[model samples]
Target: MSSTLQDLVNRAVFYSTEVQTHFGALIADAEWEVDFSSDPHLTFTPADGAVLRTRPHLLGSESDREKTWLWGWENVNDFPDAIVGLSHEVRKFGAAEEVSELTTPELSLDEELALRLTLAAKEATHKWAHYPAAAGAGTTVWLLVDAAEIALPAPQVKVSVRALMQGLTQTTVTDHRAAIESYVAKRGIPTAELPEGGLRMLFADGSADLSFDDQRRISNCDLNAPLEGEAAEQFAAAAESTGTPAEAATASRTSGSASAPAAEETAAPAVPTPSAPAPTPTDEPSRTEPQPVEEPAAEAIPVAEPKPDEPAAEAADASHEQKQPENEQPRADESVQPAEAATPAEEEPAEEAKPKKKGLFSKLFGR
Candidate 1:
């Protein structure tokens, strides 16, 4: 009976944990116990959990000596016995003593779960606890607790959303683990159990850690935790804010500043190129016009002539002959000096000298 009770205690803890997971901490304020002494009793307190109130039979069937109680349950002479015969069991269970003595208000997880599950037990012959509703109300699971041992029934727990999370935890029942694993295996989840700890669920492309917190009722998805969609997307958007969001102008300025030096390196050569050759175009055409002016030596020819030598040319008869070509073109009116104009009036001298030369020739020829 002791070994059996130990196993039942383990099963009871596991059972209460599953209930807590489904109903959301129904035993948060409740305390329960499973005491095995001369008169074994399942004692507990504050039996107003959603599971207890929802399942009335958990308080046990009322004896024939029905005395008025708080909410339709058996009560003692002085008090309603909401503590449910736990006052005497206080010394046996130190936690009950602490609660009775008010030594400490806080309850450990194991103690709290045990007390709640035990309080959930009703009749010494048969005590029943419920699983989350399957189809209609819910699936009711009965635990037969007596002075000897506790017994759990092999009943189907109408699988709820909580059932999906059942096998992922450390305290799920054997049947639930089988059902969850079988279903997961059929879907090709490719599960592999770890030696150190934990269960690994594999997908076709990726995998995730299948671990749930019985206390917090959450999964430890590890790296694959919610990192997408709405809430995760909001988180992702806020993640970018860590570096401080830059404005459009600021971003552009950063890029422009980074490229500024290279642009300056390229543009440095080009800017001076235009200015360096600026005078070349103007200088080349200016030099070409003066090149033709140097070729005309007529202006320089006047510099080589002496102004005093022009009067000697009047005595030379060849100069008079040379004047014939000059008279073919008219000289400038201001340039026509008397010394330079004697050729046109030389007709009188030519006729007078011709007759004197003929008389001298006749005397020589005896004509």
Candidate 2:
């Protein structure tokens, strides 16, 4: 059978969930601020006053009023290439894979579309961490982030399984067997197919036996060894906090495709399943407070009206011009200016503009 967007989503959700859980723990109790300027970055300040910085790629934005999603590559806000270059790579991957959702500039919003697209992006771009920033006026901007601090350690059986369970509650998954298979292959975990149609995954610490029903839905998940200490506690807590896969499926059916923040809001915090303990203050890099930047005035989400098509070479040239240098360092004193209203045709390059290097997605995905 030909692959659908849902199939891509199923293959990505498990690994995405595991990495997102690790990311949440790192930024727990932290305040975030984004600056889109010559040097774009997202700063996080925890209660302990340590500064954690990450380079953010604008994946897309969801508007509650418009009930639509706008891909970053659409350039609606006239954001710099530094902030949106990765999104272009996503579009290219989508075009190559024949996934229409990734290639489409605008889409009607659904309860889970933003999260699903983010998961698909994770699979394609191999950037495992993402953040849903509330960009005022009922819009949530979904960003895929990169930083050394958010990297995942070696995979653990308990942690992976907890993420799997948590992922089922967060979004709709049609094929649990495929989800598990994709996750294992992505993570490079050893596995074997059982004679009775079950699959056994071998982890360093233990093993898990997964059985699927005739519909390819997961029926039973049995771990060879019981979890201990905090792992067991986190697993139990996640189970109690979220509904079962059956319940999630029912909700997906009844909930119409209206823009809702519940999926974005609940996905990160739903499971208290932190993959690791919070970092100590001493371990963080010492840094000054991030300078305050002026917030842009609230406006209605930009509607994705049809546009005349440009020549393929012209479009490729425009994309090349927008690709920003990945190694440009942020200046501490720099303040974010509001995005200009001028069209891309009207904007001129600065004399001091840094030379472009490989796009972020190109480096990560090697495309």
Candidate 3:
């Protein structure tokens, strides 16, 4: 049962930085023992006896890597059975900003830790502590004493702000180191040790506990915990502390109470419209008269009298030939044809042009 509990916690909080520190201290001072009825013996194990340590990074032969430690102290026989104890407390604070606002350095590591502990405590008391035990031990416990301490990471932390922004924009979840660096830059906060190995997160209050993986993302956040309500109130108070007027723009629009400004914009355009109506109709009549005359002129030019000249020229030439001798026509026509008759050959195209309107394409192709 002890091993099982330890394993469960280890799985839960293995990646947490604070939890890592706590576990490190624990591993460095841990002791494990088993007392059987057969032997009835209590063995003294060294405080640092049960710790496991190893090089967490792989490097070449000459390279040195950081060491990781897992520590625990366990005793199967010395369970605190006379009276079990449980307690809970929630400390909550909340803040709000515009959706466009950036994360601020308002929260100290200690404050965040307090929030976590508060959440953890509430969970311990209301959710987990009363759970049926695997060991079959049954008893009610009360908190005789409890304390929660918070240590916040310092300000002015250097981080890769650009990397964080880019990663966020690109939705790249894998490069958290870059994102963390970017987060530091953007928030102007100090860079703390990141989760380098398989470490995850853990939270515990006087009563309960919660944990998450190494992503530094929260798991099992209990917003319904009373602590969270206080947090929300704190956030509201923080916003009020700024003394900035609450934004009423949306409400103003909804209720039409503040429509005077919009009305001013709309009212200016109204004055011009009545004046505009008078000139619009007057200008329209002049435009229509010019357009009708121009349309007919353009249409009549091609279809009028040009094509009838082809037949008229043939008739005039036949009359001219009737007045000339056949021999003179053969001889004098070859040398001195009448200019009027010669001119009609050049003018025949003008005659053919009269039929052009019947073929829309004839005018375009110069037929």
Candidate 4:
């Protein structure tokens, strides 16, 4: 069967969600600034003085005013090959898989189109981390980022389920059941199919039982050990912030079809085929600092626009010279101070000292 964009997204979102959550926690207190010069880099500078940096590939841009998405390979702003290289891979994968959405240069936007495309790109490229940077003019440029600090450790049940719950609030999911199954398989988490049309996911610490409704929507989620502390609080907040899937579906219909094109595309740009770089030395050692509590928001970084007469050749040469090392760089987790650590002992609450419940999702959907 031909792979659809939705299929790719369903396969990728669950894993991507967990990775993004871990990434978000790492940069929570930092300010994001991007530089798209000869070499593109996204930097996160937190209050505690630890600065984290990563290489970014421009995936695409979404325009709120126009309600459209333009792929990075379109190179409307004339971004360099290094920045748009990965997007070419995504398009080629789309062409091979016959996923029209991936090959289409411009598409109508919806509440979930940008994220959905990013998820599909993640699946195709095997890149787990992404960022949506706020470009000027009501446009948001999505980027797939790479850095050592953002890599996830082995999957844990509580963290995975928490990520699923948190991810649901950010985008519309058509089939929760499918997404969960795909996630477990991709993450290599052990799971067993229940006779009653449920799934039990086993983790080192505990397991979670998921039940689907007649329509295959996640009707309820139960955990062997209740969630408590920060994880529980985060899940409760995400649940409170989002509406039911039924409500999201209704809103999506009223907004517009995510796949509909605003105009006919003449042709996709020829995919650029860059030769692979030779292997480089191991990345600089990782930092040993603690992470801060604030999340980074997508904000424009100040960059001087190239003069009209600037030569493209010179820019490409400069980019080649300035390419980042192949190995992972020192991540923010090594140097920054965590929020709890920064807090004074005298200010600690007595209630926080008491033992808390282990399970948090004892029927998340109010069965």
* Stretches of candidate 2 exceeding 4 Å from the true structure: 226-367
State the lDDT of candidate 2 residue by residue for 1-367, as single tens digits. 3456788778887777666655555555455465667577877677797778988787877666678888888866667788888999989888888899988888887755777787788777887777654444445566788777765554556666666655565566788888989887776555667657877665544456677777777666766544444434433443345543322321231112222122221222221111111223333322112211122112221211221131000000001111123222222233221111111122247865653322111111111
lDDT of 1 by residue, 218-258 (tens): 23333232223333333334334545332221222211122
Q: How many residue pairs clash in each candidate?
A: 4, 0, 22, 16
Worst 10 residues of 4 by lDDT: 312-321
- Model 4 misplacement above 4 A: 226-367
What residue pairs are clashing in model 1?
32-115, 32-116, 33-115, 133-138
Q: Worst lDDT window (10 residues) for model 2? A: 311-320
Per-residue CA lDDT of model 4 for 141-163, tens digit only, reads 66788877766555555566655
lDDT of 3 at 225: 22
Per-candidate Cα lDDT values, in order, are: 0.23, 0.54, 0.18, 0.53
Best by lDDT: 2
TM-score of 2: 0.62
Q: Higher TM-score: candidate 1 or 2? A: 2
- Which regions of candidate 1 deviate over 4 angstroms? 1-6, 24-55, 59-191, 195-197, 201-367
The TM-score of candidate 3 is 0.16
Given candidate 4, what's the lDDT at residue 173?
60
